[model samples]
Target: MGRQYAVIGTGAIGGFYGACLQKAGLDVHFLLRRDYDYVKEHGLAISSTFGDFTLPQVNAYNQVENMPPCDVVLIALKTTQNHLLPHLLPPLLKPGTVVITLQNGLGVEPEIATIVGETAQVLGGLCFVCSNKIGLGQIHHLDYGQIQLGAYGNNHQPQGITPTMRQIAADFEQANIPIQLAENLLLARWKKLVWNIPYNGLSVVLDATTDAMMKDSYGYQLSEQLMREVIAGAAGYGLEIKESFIQKMLDYTMKMKPYRTSMKIDYDCHRPLEVEAMFGNPMRAAQAVGVAVPQITMLYQQLKFLDARNIAIGN
Candidate 1:
């Protein structure tokens, strides 16, 4: 029997992965919000610079009650939904199902494991894609679609990923998305986190893009300062990423086409920013390791203030 895949929170990352799996001929179901009604009626529309195609008659569920048990659950919800886990997630797991988290942050595995179970298989994946929910059933791909996933567990001291990580990666690869299985996933998580933590927040707070921020002398300096601190925080936890490699990452993101990040999108929509997962988690980790993160801490603080003020003023 082919693996039963349930794509939870069918946003850009989940939709993209589930679409790939569906293309690969996996038994996939999308548990989405009401916006996917059109997807169920007309299937999913993926519009990319490469091309556009509609996957006709794809399965979509508006409510969890209508969903069936799945072998693997890919979770792509924003980190803002993390607190609601106890109420929203328990019923979705089968005996041996693994829930993969594609949220970019530090120290998420532990929190997810605590909610699901210590022995529950929880794979962590990093999505390097720029996409937007263009319509009810359409996802507009802007640029960059790459994935880095690995068993959050080790050969002996395992926490996430059963024996199925390789199979999952293989299935996703067959779906035509570039997917890589990493032996050391923490490095990837930290790597991705380094990019997201500062840029995403800064973009929304300042209404800037990767290039705009890099071009503006003050913003560019702030990015470097915050990123260097993040790199130090990683090393404090024994992730020895070189300064040069970190600069390369910043340069890549800076050179990307003018793109408003997820944070900027949220700010524009008046939705709550995922301040906790994207910024709070990493800054907390740095504090735990006694790594000074003054710049990031300040950014996080200001962002939190923005949210708090907005909520208070009903904006």
Candidate 2:
């Protein structure tokens, strides 16, 4: 009778965190896709730098319609699969269901808001984790596992940190995952782009890991320029991204392990990249405010071509 939790999209992000929540003794149900049968029989395995564990038997299902309504729903699906939400969310939501999206990029909470309407309290969560599903029902957590939480209001306005946000944060804290609340979801999205725009783009375009980008002089400089463009874009939207944050992110990356970005991995696997949500929208937002982002625009155009080709090949 603890919080009834449901995890939609049980891939790397969802699988890792959902396993953590379930291990913490919550009534967590996993709505899996391709790995549903494997996980249901063999359980989910997590290999983490902090620790390693496995759930011997998880409440697993393959369809939303079969899952019971839950008090909390963690949406960890890629934005590319968001079109399924209007059909996927209704059966899993009750009167006070709290929906938290752990996906990247901007404008996600607003999109979910439109689907769930007033029945659920939707929130945005930025997960700072380097983890991937290395095999069927297995997640390898390489490094970093902090979460930044923010409340989403009507029309996607920033509602600051509410008591419900605190309650969710407390739940995560009990599970040993660090969580921080952001005052504004939009500003938080912009801040995360300070690191994501550079590494996620360059990693795919240049075919390099994060350390490789940081070690090479040219790649390092281009990364800095991309960061500056993001800062300028944020400023154009009236969100001041301080100059020091660039160096702070650089230093942080320099200290972490050499990592392949999500987009880079998607490209390697021939899955669709999140170019529109991550790069295209930000570029358009900047241009609307009369700010020029030549570097970001270039990156968006290149990624657009690459993504389209991937889709074509898939077809």
Best candidate, TM-score = 2
Q: What's the lDDT for candidate 2?
A: 0.91
Regions of candidate 1 where Cα sits further than 4 Å from its true position: 154-163, 311-315
Candidate 2 segments exceeding 4 Å error: none
Q: Please count the clashing residue pairs in each candidate, in the order shown.
A: 0, 0
- Clash pairs, candidate 2, are none
Per-residue lDDT for 302 in model 2?
91
Question: lDDT per model, in order?
Answer: 0.77, 0.91
Candidate 2: 10-residue stretch with minimal lDDT = 152-161
Task: Please give the TM-score that candidate 2 achieves against the real structure.
Answer: 0.97
- Residues 164-223 of candidate 1: C-alpha lDDT, one tens digit per residue: 777778777777777777666776777776788778889877888888898888988878
* Residue lDDT tens for model 2, 1-315: 578899999999999999999899888999998999999999999999879999989999998999999989999988889889999999999999999999898878888989899899999999999899999999999988999999998745779889999999988988899999998888999999999999999988899999999999999899999999999999987888899999998888887778889999998888999888899888998898999999999999998988889778977
